[model samples]
Structures are given as structure tokens and as C-alpha cells.
Target: MVDIRSPCILVCSIDVKSGFCFGCGRTRAEIASWLSLTSQERDTIMAELPRRLETVERRPRRETRRARIARQRREGQ
Candidate 1:
């Protein structure tokens, strides 16, 4: 069985609002099912991803500068 190549482009981060991965263009369910699919099946999903992404509405991320500073301080860098 040929392993289906992941569409993940090393961008593991998901948009908190959209519940979609910014890197691979996959939903949480799809990502979870990746290993279970054949390469051909994966290809079909990949082909449809662009259109799906276009239709998804993403929530805006709210990050304050103060919060960023606090996080940086905690990281000790």
C-alpha cells in the first residue's frame, strides 16, 4: 500500500476561528483521517481543497502587544 503524502506544508498551526489548518488546507477530521487513506484518495481531497478553502470563513485572531510581551518574557529570551 502506498502511503498517501501529506498536504501539510510544515504549517501545523490551525486558525482558531476557522478550525482549519493553515498549512495543509485540511479540517481537523481530514487531518485525523490522513493515515487511513490511500494516495489516490488523498489526491482527490487535495484537488478539492482550494475551492473549500475559498469558501471557509476565518475568525480574526486577537493578540495584544502586551500579551505578546508577556509571553516573550516568560520564554526567557
Candidate 2:
């Protein structure tokens, strides 16, 4: 199966305040139509993710497994 480009880290919960995914920082509409979007479109969205994530008021209940791994890797580096 071809893996389309995605920022998902398997944390599939949405932040109610921002309407963006707690993990990938994408809205439900974006996530639902991701595969159908062009590379440029995805890139545009990806560029905004960090900023969008910062706007999330309510955080996830706990650290996601993928997030922990990424943190460990960054710390190790």
C-alpha cells in the first residue's frame, strides 16, 4: 500500500477548542480529504500545523506513545 504523505503520529483525537487534531494539527475536514489533496495543498497545510497546534487550548489527556518516542529521540540527539 502506498503511504501518502501525512503528519499523523497516530494520536487521533481532536481538540474541541481548535477543531484540529491533537496530534497532527489538522481539522476533521482536512483529515477526511487528505489523500485527495495535492502535494502543494498538503504542504500548505503542513506549514500551518505548528502554528495551529500552538493555538490548541485544551491538550490531550496524556502523552501519546508516538509523542513520547519522538521526545526520547530528540533528547537523545
Q: Superposing all C-alpha atoms, what RMSD in Å does each candidate have to the true structure?
A: 6.1, 5.3
| Residue 74 CA displacement from its true place in model 1, Å | 20
Model 1: per-residue Cα lDDT over 1-77, one tens digit each: 55557777654556666677665678888898999877778889899788666654543254434456678899996
lDDT by residue for model 2 (1-77), tens: 76678999888788887898888999999999999998899999999999998988656867776677789999995
Given candidate 2, what's the lDDT at residue 2? Answer: 67
- C-alpha lDDT of all candidate models, in order: 0.70, 0.87
TM-score for predicted model 2 compared with the true structure: 0.72
- The candidate maximizing lDDT is 2
**Model 2: how far residue 11 lies from native, Å:** 0.7
- Pairs in clash, predicted candidate 2: none
What are the clashing pairs of model 1? none
